[model samples]
Target: MNNLFLRNQLCVPVKGYNRAIIYDILRKDYFLIPKEHCAILDTNDFIQFDKIEDVEEREELIDFLVNEEIIFQLSTSEQKKHFKSLNRNFENPNPLTNVIIHSNIDFRFLDLIKDQYLLNLSIISQEIDDNLLAILQKVSELEIDSIYLYIENSNIEKLDEYKKLFANYSLIFSVNFFNSKKIIDKTQLSQNIYYNFFEEEFSTYKRTLSIDKLAINAEHFLEAYNFHSYYFAKVYIDENGNIKNGLNNLENFGCIKSLTSSQFKEIISSSNFKELGTIKKKETLVCCDCEYRYMCVDSRVPSKGKKHWFHQFECVYNPYLSKWSNEEGYLNLEESGVYISASGCTIDQEKLSENFDKIWNT
Candidate 1:
């Protein structure tokens, strides 16, 4: 008997309450499949197609999988033995990889975490001043990979100065001047750097999820499987030098100035600080049943529950109904009978079952 196997890439089949998603890392895309189909893939071995329902529906599904290059046929057990699935486990050598600065304090405290070799540095400031230049000069000395500058209130008159400052630092690769009096064409800057001028205000706390934010790459999929893509190994320092996981995060570990090298490391390594990053989407309510769980990066702070976490804000997309909030014929998750509370999430199984065929059979 012939056997079916997923293609060379590590294709992960995740089952939701209503549907399932196949994350094709190689193609950088995903396919929505029925929960039953996901269960079939969950077997994760040389599949005997003949052993399935053997109906027209099953044949069509198998054909789709083959034609899309998601799966291939192997004639013999000997041939199957040579095929191996890739390991999806992720590991990072650095304890901290990214730093976000929202203040103009003496950032010299960065020396405490410099040993890990920071990959990215973000600075959020109100204006372009000598303080900004000083910070840029100091950071340019470090072996930092890249710097992202976000100025909330920008002065158009300083573009030439900004260009000169950026040219001085090779690591300052991206810059965004928000609330600019006049919009500047992006092409006005050097090709090596990404500089944009926006007349509208940009808030760090106001976040919204959309299909455009979904990253279908292998690195993101593997990391999202085990950790929070935004908060993991990332630190945010507010204007007063207070450190937190995110800008909106209320809990502050402590001010950077007051902390010693040992204390700083202890704080980051402690469960209290690391717990937020451990909250993977697969372990959260509503998000647990999302087809885009691993691919979508939703970093909004969540309310803690006994077993699972609840989103403090409503998600724009409903995985149960497979519809966006803005689209017509879209019913909110609550209308579908899934309730999120302090304890966790509770679902109306009967309602889910009744709607199953209506959704899939369409």
Candidate 2:
């Protein structure tokens, strides 16, 4: 008890003054305690604190924090920090590559990522037309391993034609219907074309990184969490033939006619491009408190609501309350308080405003 010290963890404040969160990085657990109790974590030697004023039960909070490994006894005074290993590159020879190609009813001019064996492609099209076959043909030529076509399921008038055409490409294609569309056809489809079926709303998160995915890819994800992109390396050709960081992000990087895969990569790697993209859950508001932050597939371009950090307005989980709603939960993100735009952990006000301006003006 005497030798124990609070482990290095992340402390964040919820919007309301009532609650705050302490994320224990070592154990990958989070605790919601009173905002007043946050001072206990401020000092290196928490043992020096005798009383926490606002807390009704100080001992209880301490006991819970200790039990959660948020507080632990160090074996020595070394104060050493641990880092993740970077030795797995040699193991993955071919490497798994995923990309998204957004075409505005045209795929004839598409040319990017020509060399890599694409493991996945998510195509977002305004309408299904004759060019689709050309796109699929090009995909097959590119040796694209699998695909998920996002379109209005009900609007698919050529189901039979689609079945026949898609069958020829030999792609493991899934259809994601937006606008709350359901698979009404009731047709027993072949093994190749899978339906995007969600028994519940939480299942929607399965398409992104969720708990189940975290359990499987924890080690790999932990090492490469920064590379997580909501659009997943999208090379979008908007309806107007303009290219942006992603389909969700409107900031125009260049025109589809001029940009190449290599150029697209360079643009994304630039500071201006990264300023708008490359946000991880841990860097976000409430998402930082979740135990699954590292493993979760986060959104790069979520709806910009009232708060910069509260990107997921439809989120059901409330980390501060440690509760979830069947419907929309509280959406206030725990901002780092440094930036009015967002916390320092996320994009700053300067970068955010600049990107938005660039998107509108460009």
Report the number of the highest-lDDT candidate.
1
Where does candidate 1 have its weakest 10-residue lDDT segment?
A: 1-10
Candidate lDDT values, in order = 0.77, 0.50
Q: Please report how far candidate 2 places residue 301 from its true position, in Å.
A: 3.4
Candidate 1 TM-score versus the reference: 0.81
Q: Model 2: per-residue lDDT, tens digit, 1-362?
A: 45445444332222222346554434444455666666656554434345655454766766776676566665555642441223222122232255556544345334555666666777765446654556766676676768877653335455566667566656757765444335454334565676553323322433343333332232334333454434434345566666665545567877656766677557645666555344555556556555445444554465333444545343444343333443233222332121223332343456444543443356
Candidate 1 ranges beyond 4 A from true positions: 51-56, 103-105, 127-133, 151-200, 349-362
**For every candidate, C-alpha RMSD to the true structure in Å:** 4.0, 11.0
Give candidate 1's error at residue 323 in angstroms: 2.0
Task: Provide the lDDT at 327 for model 2.
Answer: 28
The sequence of per-residue lDDT tens digits that candidate 1 reaches over residues 1-362 is: 24545454467788876689888887898898988787777655765555567578878888898887777877655676677776778898777888888637666686777666888888887788788888888777677889988888876787777787678778988888777646646434574787876555767323667675689888889889889887888888888888899766888899888888888888888888988888888778888888888898786898888888888678888887777777765666677667888787778978865664455566
Colliding pairs, model 2: 209-297
Each candidate's number of clashing pairs is 1, 1
